[model samples]
Target: MNSSLFAVIMMLAVLIPSGMQAQAPATYYNSAYGKSGKALKTELHEIIKSGYVTKSYDFLYTIYEESDTRPDGKLWDMYSTCTWTHGQKKCGNYSTVCDCYNREHSIPQSWFNERSPMVSDAHHIYPTDGRVNGQRGNDPFGECANGTTLTNGLGRSGSSTFPGYSGRVFEPVDEYKGDFARTYFYFVTRYEDLMSTFSTSSTSFSGNAYPSLNSWSIALFLKWHRQDPVSEKEIVRNNAVYKHQKNRNAFIDHPILAEHIWGTLQGSAWDVTGVETPAELLARVNYNANERSMMVAADLGELSYEVVNISGVRLLSGTLLGGDAVSMGSLKPGVYFFRANADTLKAVKKFIVQ
Candidate 1:
């Protein structure tokens, strides 16, 4: 064989096996294609349920050491910025903020009465400062306004400041907001059937697979999911957990799936079509905000568009021809979301109407 041909064959041999391995696990989601709402959520639950390996609470320490460590090789404590030595703070009682970290149930165990799988689920458990973990104490996540009780740079526990709920709650820093939102999304979907048996006093979780979160909490989490987006840390942790638990969080794999299941973007657009990357969908259309109009690329073919306010109220809806502009001249000066939809395409862009 020619040297060049042999080199090409060698490269292919090395790449083929790794590529196949990467694609194998995701094949579990094949049945979920073109599904949305309750159907999508239930399909995911069943697909992921098969691989879940329940670990004891004690096992989490070993897992966190591998999964939650910061790049600097220190324990990654979400509740505080304190640096912790590895394994120094495993489940120890603390009266104040210490140098050690402990297992924190982002979803408190008491909420489910310490049920087996839910109690030990690493998807919702994090390693955080022991003192701050105590302060959080099963509180539902929310923004704090007044009556501050604990402030640890990275998290806070206090009276609720967020609208729609006025109970005490714990709020993590902005950096991890999307991370927690995805985790919550995973919790509701993966354990949708088990939610009815858990406490709902401080939770927004409902028993149903669709609309699993109550209105207020859903709105808050959706906003957070968009604002923070997904980060590399989340992607890395998600892959690590999949290795241990044998299931993947579909929301992390496809962030838009959350919208299909519970948010405003649901319908046949997402139901009949598979998920698309934001860039792939956005590349199909272009918006000229100065003229308050959008132009669909010819390759995208004909499409429909809607202009909605930040609150998701539809202000205008119309069809757009390929290569032609759809005017938004009648829209009032404000912020709005430009949503484009086609048979197999869905994209949303935020624009200011000034």
Candidate 2:
């Protein structure tokens, strides 16, 4: 073959493969066009259902070592900060915190009677310490308060501390709260049809597609979702799961979809072909600690702003002529939302006060 022709062929080979790799996610998301609310949820369920590769329950031990590994190449055990080994770390008998890492169903299997698909779904199953898993057994996720029973530093299980809940509950550390929230989002969306059959042991889920989460659980999970955002671990695990299951968790790819579905930013119009541009801009708002202010670049001529705590308590509110700043006041350090409202546009952005 001629040298020029051979070079052109080689370039085509590299560019073709690279282009496909880059467009894979967009291609997968294309099926969700013109979808929102329950329609969107159901569409995603169908889109993801096709590529599922079911594995036996025992296979999760090997899978977790790869899918949940941390930055240091160690097993990512959420129940405790232990350096768990791959094959040897299977739980046999554990009486302590870091004894072994085992498969934990973030959504208790008993809720679905240990059925297929949901039982082994990697989205809700995690690699957690066995002892802590036992502590969290069958208890729904919630904040624990009085009558605390277990505290492994990475997790707590006890009587409910959250409002509107009065049952034994399990709460993972703050670092993994968003992880669990996104997983729960995936579970509900992927299995929207089956939700009605699963037992609502906790008030967290409502067993329906639209407004799939209860009021209190929506508040709690939304808070965690905004606070934690998506991390490198989540992205990597998302891709790994896609490789194994042939399906992707849409929320991990598009976090703003959570808000569009059931949280604060619900009812905002979004582009079904891709991620919402307005939500992306809102998420990128800058927080200036030195100025004690938050700002987003938008041309909303005359707008009002409000700073609210995670519990929906209004801390500060005022009007802003375009480009004017809103003071952070003497509010204590914690996660807060900065909401901007105009004639027809409204946006909510989350920022942390250190």
Model 1 clash pairs are: none
Q: How much does candidate 2 score in TM-score?
A: 0.70
Candidate 1: tens digits of C-alpha lDDT, residues 1-354? 565755554443233222212222536678888878888888888987887999888888877766676544677787887888777756556677764578888888887898889888888899888788888788888888554545453677788888888888888776577788888989888888887777778876665556777777888798788755554355556666777888877776677888888777667334324334433455556557568777777766677877778555888888877787887788886656677766534546555454
Model 1, CA-based lDDT: 0.71
TM-scores of all predicted structures: 0.70, 0.70
The lDDT per prediction is 0.71, 0.69
Name every residue pair that clashes in candidate 2.
none
